[model samples]
Target chain A: MKDALLREIGKVVIPFIQIFGIYIILNGHLSPGGGFSGGTILGVSLIMHKLIEEPYKSRIKISERAVMQFTCVSLILYGLLKGYSFITGGGEFELLDIPLGIPGRILSGGMLLPLNVAVGIIVCFTIYTFYTLFDKGEI
Target chain B: MAAAANFPLLIILILFLSSFMMPVLKRVKAVKWLSLSSILLCVVLSVLTLAYVQQNGAFLYKVGHFEAPWGNELKIGYLEAIMSIMFTSIAALITWASFFSADYEIKEKNIMLYYTLCGMLLASLLGILYSNDIFNCFVFIELSSIAACGIVVVKDKKENIKAGVKYLILSSLGSGLVLMGIAFLYSITGNLNIGFIHQELVKVKDLYHNTLIISLGLFTVGLGVKSAMFPVHIWLPDAHTYAPSSSSALLSSLVLKAYILLYIKIIYRVFGIEIVKTLPILEIVLVMGAVGMIFGSILALLQKDLKRMIAYSSVAQIGYIFFGIGLGNILGLMAAIFHIISHALTKSALFLIAGNIIERIHSKEISRLKGIGIEMPITLGVFVVCALSMVGIPLFAGFNSKWNFALAIIDSNRILFIAVLVASSLLNALYYLPIIINAYFGEENTKDRVYMSKEKSLGALLPILILAFAIIYLGISSNGIIDLIAKSVSNL
Candidate 1:
């Protein structure tokens, strides 16, 4: 965990992993990789950063409470969004429809994109918390 | 009026959404109130939905934009409406009761998580009850299983963890079998909707006889385990015994009943009676139910722990339900449905009473509860009502269910099983009567007890008392309920 070479490699590799995860999450509707897989990839990067960096000296710090708050907010937002859709769609109300962009575009798929982002955030925090809790029995 | 149709979906959404909110809130009191009020709203919505159903009729609501075959659907009927009302009201009462006692039994930090799990469990149970699609019900089944296990393990004790793991494993296996059954049904019928499957099966009945039978067997045994049916109820006593009192009440009263309702749906809705009668499964179910009635009571008689004894009594009561189902007649199924409601009321009250005793005395051994009536007069009095109901004393809810079973048996020409019912009631008395006797009477038991010293607060006892009142109310005026159940069964 304290190896110099591994830390150097992780510093170089972690940014790419996060960027790719974001890309997958953003393009989930048009591509195979979605919230779960992409968020997992991001989570692995986080775990790696925690593993490689010195505990006290790490520039980026996420507290357990912060993680819980983020997860809860994302989940509530997701539920509300889905509930809205279900109500509008089931009741056949043509109210506040999110315009669907072109089918292949990154920003397409109306509500699906936001839902994927919410799910990604939730999964990312959940996985990170799981890792931290298992690794040190605290967070 | 039209908006009432959306109550079913709204109830589920509110429960799930509020459950997620519990962890973020800093105040534990806020979390508890949020859980209680949300469930109360659901109970009101359910009653409205029931009224709507009574005025109109059963209607299928589309989950989203798509229609029945493609999208998820919720079927609300007389049965579903009544069941939702029962589930929500009982859950509301249990949550209300837990408000006072949860702090004592569970760790302070874990109390929020306990409410969260209860909310999730209720939502998922409602999901199982209302879903019209088989795959949707399967998803709910998995959710309920996890939530159920979570509630059991939330006590955070060694025995709780062990019992929870055992329950988790068995419940997962039950869900897995259900998934396999769904796969079998889907592969053959090419549909996940219950109505469509029934239609497809009617068309292909002769062609896929063995496949139908296999799928049927899978459903029965799978749901049997989840509902603590005769042979597969091994995990129940431990999990119920170790869980917090409110959790035990919810598990015993509501969770198992939802699974049994799902089983009933699978049998009557997915596979129509015409197709099911061709198989020998009903006779097998009858035999198992009869055996469970005797053996479950016998096992209960042997347990020293009070909660464990009541948990075994659940097994026996479930036997009566399955017996009604196994009778393969309309009246029998009616009895099963009625018993579901009666048992839900009686058993939850019993468990809450058990919880009250444990909270007051800090003990679970039946022997330690000597002369408890002298200390906790009202609590033990309520217990006497529930016990007499369990023993099938006339004019009690339990007696009506047993009476229905007897009539159903005689109607089905299974007069021999009537003796089994009588024997099972005797066995029930054998276990329940002794505790009542020891709690209230005898010189040694009452010598050192103080009057009303161990009674729970009125707020805490209020729910159990209401449940007791409902039992007596139902006992005296069951004709209306029986008629309603008959209507629902006829609709089925």
Candidate 2:
């Protein structure tokens, strides 16, 4: 809110927060932290950035429509991906099998990586939108 | 033919996936068309599924790759197939009707959200109907509750929001109790699948008597509240009255029926009827249901608001369903299922008619509806048919259900409760007949009204007329449906 100290600290902190969020999303199948928690962390960083930079004219712009479209697209992709898996698995068809990679790798979990990424995008946008809507009543 | 087996799962997926597309689409008309067309597709799929079931018998479909004990499953039977058809078709009709009237009731921007909620709600309701696992049912129950509450508050009025909060809080409590019940069942049986749990429960029948009773009570009261059973139906009137008319129709006709269906599955599949009959729970249910029949109608008689009155009638009709279940006989349960069909048709038509009248007259007060028939002749004529059905007039759907209920009572050697049925019908008449009389006959009421002046277009009235025709058709040929229900009950 026009505070120089907080803005300086935020600039230093936000990048690390975002990188850690991405790491968790990438390693979701191999670790405890996954899409939801990682996405929440990223969302908090966004909220902090918005709070500190909202008073400045040069802040990064994120339109409400873009956030909504991103959320909806991610949700649709998530549904389609999961629905494909369910149909193929339930019907016992071996169609489009992405070979499972080494167990500890980021790509090891067939569809889990893509699903996690989609969920992460959705949760991130959703949380940021919630913040904006509550903060200003129009998101 | 093999692919037809997957229609149940496809119906759920189509609804959920298509609903997410609503907000992303720019055109409202496209969103509405998409919503209607998806529901129509489900209707066709459901009818195909039912036909497949009729030919092949009930089958269980595994969700994803997991087997029965480990993963989710959908048990599609005669009951489920029929229910899916009913839910999808009725929802399609309601969405079509609301297409004409939603702009008047809901804000332009919020209309897309309304369709989204309806889609989600129908999907979740179908989920509840098809789920073979107790925990799966619980998840669907929670989803349906939230979607139901969302549709209620989507009207964006202060009263709607207040009613929505009331409904949400009470419904959450209902869900919490259901979760606890599932926990109790899971702990004792070590399985979530209904068939597996039944096997385990039958083996250990005598070991955990008290726990069994507690879990049974929890399920009964929890689902009872969700379905608007007698004592716990307080939130229903406000929520239904304040919601948009299509939402009200869906709530009264479809949503409440799903929970009751789930309850029926629990009683029959999880805990067999022989085991349940030994407990005092069925007797309590029977008494409560009988009381609800009388009190719900009595309450309906006191409501001045037309929607509130119709909402209370739902409570009374639900009592009849529970009463049928409580009879704990084959015929009784069959009657309950049949009543579900009849009530779904009759009540949806009634609510949509109410919407038509409200749209044209800009009023919801029953007093203001006097001589409305003189203006909206066809709408009131449909209403008269629906009211007669509610009053159990011979050759209407309600009469057949009451007849079956009486036979079930006699079959169970509970002939005294037949009086409750008669009294409840009289009470139904007390509330419904006066409006019909004032609408059609009174001189002062009819003097100023122009015939056909307030009638909706033929396209708008077509759904209600079809529903009315279905009601009469059901009444005339209920034997076939009753036989089908009997087979389903035997399958249970």
Candidate 3:
């Protein structure tokens, strides 16, 4: 875990992993890959950094407070949007009156894309928090 | 504030929204009050919904504005409204009771999580009660199971964690079975909606008889485990006993009832009454219920821990509900429904009072409660009232339920069930009466122990007092409840 070679390799590989995850999240409705899959990748990248680097050497550490806040905010946003759609008697596909942009594009899914972003944030933050809680009995 | 049609979904929304916000709230006191007020609002909304349902008859609200047969829907009927009202009221009371005792029972850091779990658990139960789609019900079942486990483990004791893990494992298995059954039904009927599935199944009843029977069996075992039906009740005692007392009260009083109600809905709504009659599941349920009635009482009688004894007694009480359902008659179903309310009030009061007693005296053993009545007269007084009700004494809530159950089964050929009922009540008395007798009449108490505290905390005492009053009120107004449930059952 304290190997310099592994840490260097993780640093090189993490950016690609994050970019790929972001791609999957943004293009979720266009393809089969969605929020959960993308979020796992992002979460695994952060976990990888924790595993490879020495505790004091990691430059990009996510605080538990930040993770908790992010998870709560994202989930609350999702719930609110879902609740709005439900109360307005519209489908999940229609959060507001926004047009379903051009098909096969990154922004084509309307509420689904934002919802996917929220879900991805929740998944990523929850995964990170879950690891912290499991490793150290606090989060 | 909106149309009556929106209330069911609104209840679910309010619960989930508030629960999701609990972690963000810094002050545990604020979280507690927020949960209580929201749940109290749910109770008011549920009551209004009950009246709305009575006036408007059963109605379905399609979520996402989708068509009913294809999309998720919330079905509000007389039965669903009755269940919602029961759930919200009981939940409100439990949360209220927890406000006082939580400081003593739950650690400070975990208090917010505790309330959050309770809120999520109630929300999921409400979701289960109103959801018309089988898949939706399964999802809610999973959510509730997790919340239930969270509440158990929140105590942070080794045994609580063990019990929560055991509950999680067994409940997941139950959920797996339920999901499998839902899959089978969906495969055959191509619909997850209960009403649509019923229609499709009836049309092709003969074509898929074997698969249908298998699905029914899966449902029976699955729900049986979740509700802790007799043989599959291995997880109930420890899980219920080790949980924080308020959680235990909610678990024993309301959580199990929701599963049983869902089972009844599946049998009566999806399979139809005639099909269930043709199947042998009810007979199996009847026999298992009778055995559980006796077995659970025996187990209760053997328990050293008072909470564990009450926990075991729940199995026997659940048996009464199942036994009534197995009677397959309107009168029997009505009796079961009435018992749901009576048992909810009585058991919750008992658990709350038991929590108070343990907190006051630092004792969990039944033998140590000698002359406890002398110190905590009002608490023990409520305990006595609820205990007599549990024992089926005349002029009490349990008596009305037992009386109707007896009348329901008297004309039927299941004479053995009547014998089982009598035996169980006698068994109830055997275990319950001793505790009361020892608390009052036994001379094990010294003078110092007799004058500990005459006054109970307002928070701990109020819910118990209200529940005790509700028990007596229900007992005195038994006829009105019987008629209401009779109409509800007839409507079903």
Candidate 4:
């Protein structure tokens, strides 16, 4: 039955999926995974929630209103950093981090870890943003 | 501060995290104000980067201070600076306008997600702009494509979703080809920095002729797809047609141009002018550009849908940039860069105005645009000014750039090219000028201004006006912009 498919795709199973997403995000700088991969995983988990749960309840999980505001803020943060860099003369498009850690280690590279984390957030919220719109039958 | 030297990447990370937080903040009544403050702070920061670009010519920074021969590097230069300014300046303005529109278009539900994607889009764009190495560029490219896909598909309507799928597949193929080319270049040159690779290429040019040629061909193909060159333009019309207006502005204006900028870097900087001048490669690119100019414009003229027509027009305009590069003269190259700025101004301005019209009329078909101009005069006026610019009428951004392009072509003394330019400009008029005439002189519906939002839409309108005015301003004071472009292109 479709219900069984939904049951298997529930939060219990989805949490593990979300965790996997987290790992990919955190370890993005080291291996092939990065913000995009991790973020996509989070998006997939949200989809899992959609399959198993009632649409309305899951609506609150990733509110469309929130993604709008978040996407705006995320961009502004990039602007703010560059603006600050410009003011202080670090040069625009400058890279960051110690890369003190081993090449393959987590937290080892400069801003790659941070970059991955940012991408992960974007991926998850964007995916959820899509789901919210779709399930609302607004799409 | 050096303490925050990692600021470039941090910006994206913070934005990514904020996407997660944005949905939560929507619960708070004050969230709108909060978002405003944050974005303004960021915009101010983005504006600050121009000073840095002016001060530092260009350099690559290794993430974590890891030397680039071993680890990846973030390339910061004049080109990157220009791209950042373009991306952030327009992005901030649009997002600001979106803030006001969010009050209307977005329901109580979807506003935060919209903001999140906006940030993702910015970060991905910045990532693309800042990445020094080709592989790193690929990552950002994918990030941009994915985020863009999200924004376009956010509507989730069948048309929008279908557009997103097309965008994704075409973008992926483009990226795949670019990656393969990067691999090939790395194998021969053993380096990726444009200048450094130039050195390596010379040392090994004799031994690796086939590989070099193949890789160059691949890079051309890859970047061509992204640039939406004549043969590789299948995805652009749909992607541009289907996305929301702000999203369309970003896609048509910034995203496609960014890829083209990469092509400039790949051809001029990576391979060096010596090769471009000596080899027949410039001819290949030039020929493609000439065809794009004539072909894209002709296609644009036939479209009934305003957005689809505009999309096709972009395909044509991109050719102008390539034409400048193809001419391979200082004036020609300068003209190309100048045209890039002009087209960005004209195109994004038009798209924004189109957004206003779409909001009011609830349609993008050219036929439905009848008499709608009466109610939305300002929006229509902006569209007219921009269309004139596209047609390269005198005293607009398009005119100055076209003049430079003409001079460049004449200097090259290729009579066929002159014909191509003349023919294409006429073709450009064919598509764009008619739209303006139709809007102004067409049949009128009842003049009703119900639900018109121009006063509140000033945030969006101001940029269009500034750009349109600049078109005229740049046309009159063409020397300044031309000098800047000359300096920049010559440096490249």
Stretches of candidate 3 above 4 Å error? A90-99, A102-108, A133-139, B443-454
Say which prediction, candidate 1 or candidate 4, comes out ahead on DockQ: 1
Cα lDDT of model 4 by residue, B1-492, tens digit: 333334455555455555445555636345555444445555555445545545655555655324566556666555555656666666666665555555444445555556666666677767766766777777878887888787787665788889899989988899899999999988887887655778888787778877877887888888888779888999999988877777788778778877877777777777777765656778898999999999999899889998889989999999989888888888887788788788887888877777777776678888887655555677777788888888888878788888888898889888678888889888888877766666556434434534243332566577777777867787778885565566566567
Per-residue C-alpha lDDT of model 1 across residues B347-398, encoded as one tens digit per residue = 9999999999998889999999999989999999999999999999988999
The lowest-lDDT stretch of 10 consecutive residues in candidate 1 chain B is B448-457
Off by over 4 Å in 2: none
Model 3 over residues B92-134: C-alpha lDDT tens digits? 9999999988899889988998998899999999999999899
Off-target runs (Cα >4 Å) in candidate 4 are: A1-139, B1-24, B27-43, B100-110, B442-460
Docking class of 1: medium
Question: Each model's TM-score, in the order given?
Answer: 0.98, 0.98, 0.96, 0.78
In the order shown, the candidates' Cα RMSDs to the true structure are 1.3, 1.2, 2.2, 6.5
**lDDT of every model, 2 decimals:** 0.93, 0.92, 0.87, 0.72
Evaluate model 3: give its lDDT. Answer: 0.87
What C-alpha lDDT, on a 0 to 100 scale, does residue A81 get in candidate 1? 91
The interface RMSD values of the models, given in order, are 0.9, 0.9, 2.4, 8.2
Tens digit of lDDT per residue, candidate 1, span A1-139? 7688898888899999999999999989998989888899888888888888965379888887788788888988999999888888777777898889999998899999999999999999889989988888888
DockQ of every candidate structure: 0.75, 0.74, 0.50, 0.11
- Model 2 over residues B73-173: C-alpha lDDT tens digits? 89999999888999999999999999998999999989999999999999999999999999999999999999999999999999999999999999999
Instruction: Report lDDT (Cα) of residue B248, candidate 2.
Output: 96
Model 2: per-residue Cα lDDT at residue B286: 88
